[model samples]
Target: MNFDSYASDVMAATVEAVNQLTPGHARGRDYPAARPDLGDLVGEAAVSSEDVDELRAYAFKIREIFVAVDDNRIDDACEATNTLLAETQAAPTLSRHGGEPWHLHFHTPSERWARGWAAPMATALAIVLGNPMHDRLGVCTATVCDRVFVDVSRNGTKRYCSTACQNRVKAAAFRARKQV
Candidate 1:
């Protein structure tokens, strides 16, 4: 049930990055934003208005890649994935930062926000590729929602992104049965 330590860290970071970009909980929930420049693991830099829009679009693109991976479409999934990987120049290494001990690192020093995202994402996927658990990357099947997640559970049986959605679907099923 254990994954590579490096890959595990990268996956955790990828999830963290996505969460930073679009928090999973209710909208407008107050949470600390990622600071990519201040040497924080989640750095913070001034993002332009246009950059915000671009990031949102890129998030959806990432979600699409996850969906492709889940559907067993390797060519389509890797197409989008390779674009991200090539753009970011993701490389693997072990380094220490922020007083932490040596750990796997996967980013070059760059000020661009896109590079900040691409590096970590590509590194995370690389970890998945190296291990058999690459199948963990997937999108939720909830209608009207397309959020991505890394299934880190021991049972490998995660489906929805949150309890609210699970409840929503359950309630719909109950209502249908009652009507019948």
Candidate 2:
């Protein structure tokens, strides 16, 4: 299930950024009002207020992709992905930062959060579309929970974010079958 090393890193970072931007327990904090750290990832490009708005929209779009996948609505997921892909222009290159080795990268020179996110996200989608890994994008199966994950596992079999959620789902299912 390994993609190209650089693509894997970029996808990993993309997932992290999505999690950071989205409200969730995994982050251990509420979503920030201002994410200066996002600017670092996007580079020194000009980011407008509109760009931030758009980024939020796209974050929700990513959320929709997860929900659609959970519902087994592949058409909706594909449509959402196409919308994101249309908004992005990802080109791959190599760069070094934070003492990390040179790696495959994709970006635009915009400082705006949404614009900055577009390229990397688009690149991640490209990897997913090109490889079997695309099926890995999914939502948690726990009842009353809606978290997303990119299951980059050898078995393509990740169903929940934590054991707690797994147990919750199992318990719920057991109760449902008993009532039936």
Candidate 3:
């Protein structure tokens, strides 16, 4: 359970998935057709429409963690994460399967995609929150996007979800200056 790598990878992907897959106003991706990362996170399980529905709801819950972190409410984020962990029954188990090296997994081997994901997402977030890296989780500052991101930079100054969003904000500022 390396919190840095685990949170940067798994939790990052899950947060991005929530931004993409969650129902909302015109996010820029064709979520179902474009999300191969979701498949990777769920391992061999297929994602169904029902799973998407579940994830859409779950996205709101996950957002609470990010929002709490963003608002400097670490305890609120922890409480929310604790509830999710309890609900998901997260357990850390290590095993080597499919010829891969032994690594940690949070859900039972047979858990459904949504439930399975809930456990690890919560666990990864918990790892981050418990450590000094709790501030690593953030919501994008871009006006058009509410995507979450993990700040993995050396200086930890990251503020947007992606370079595109960063550029968008910069360009918007430039346009505003030009208009003025």
Candidate 4:
């Protein structure tokens, strides 16, 4: 099964986590990021208050990977992703969950933290990066936003993390041109 989309969701979520946890960049108007909400992303995994810091750190690393990609530092991104993938030790298998069709599973029941929360995304990236679709990993192109996204479009040309960000950027540009 194609894990690209699943991996992209993880990347986007991790980027959001990073932007939330490490604030104070002082870019522009205040748009409060959603608090490090790993619960929605973890999907049935038990997350504790004590797990926040570790998850945050893990997210930072994921952010670094996307930042490297956005900065056109492919080598750095590869290195960072590889390091994370190695640490995760993902093992691929086929399984069904939540009444969904059978799909490839990257983490085991015993895996937690890195494997449980992070490995699937890491393995997804590994799967894509091994192919020509490596460039799909990217950061949001919206101003005052440092989120990440994966381009699964047919032409692979995705910019903003979401439609909202796209509209914001376009509106900002329109206002700028009007003022000029």
CA lDDT, every model vs. true structure: 0.62, 0.65, 0.77, 0.68
* Model 2 quality (TM-score): 0.65
Tell me how far the alpha carbon of residue 80 in candidate 4 is from the true structure, in angstroms, after superposition: 1.2
Error of 4 at 171 (Å): 1.4
Model 3: ten consecutive residues of lowest lDDT = 25-34
lDDT of 3: 0.77
Q: Least lDDT summed over 10 consecutive residues: which range in candidate 4? A: 23-32
User: Candidate 1 — worst ten consecutive residues by lDDT sum?
Assistant: 31-40
Tens-digit per-residue lDDT, 12-117, candidate 2: 6666555556664442224453552454555666666676567666676677776776677777777777777777656666777779997665664333466556
Candidate 1 Cα errors over 4 Å, as ranges: 12-58
Model 2's lDDT to the true fold?
Answer: 0.65
Residue runs of model 4 more than 4 Å from their true location after superposition? 1-34, 93-103
TM-scores for all predictions: 0.70, 0.65, 0.84, 0.76
RMSD (Cα, Å) for all candidates, in order, is 5.2, 5.2, 3.3, 3.6
Of 2 and 4, which scores higher on TM-score?
A: 4
Q: Local error of candidate 1 at 9, Å?
A: 4.1
Kindly indicate the candidate among 2 and 3 with the higher TM-score. 3
- Give the best candidate by lDDT: 3
Q: Identify the superior model by lDDT, candidate 1 or candidate 4.
A: 4
The Cα RMSD in angstroms, rounded to one decimal, for candidate 1 relative to the true structure is 5.2
lDDT tens readout by residue for model 3, 63-177? 8898899999999999999998998899988867788998888988787778777788888888899998789888888775677778878788899888988888898899999
lDDT of 3 at 24: 43
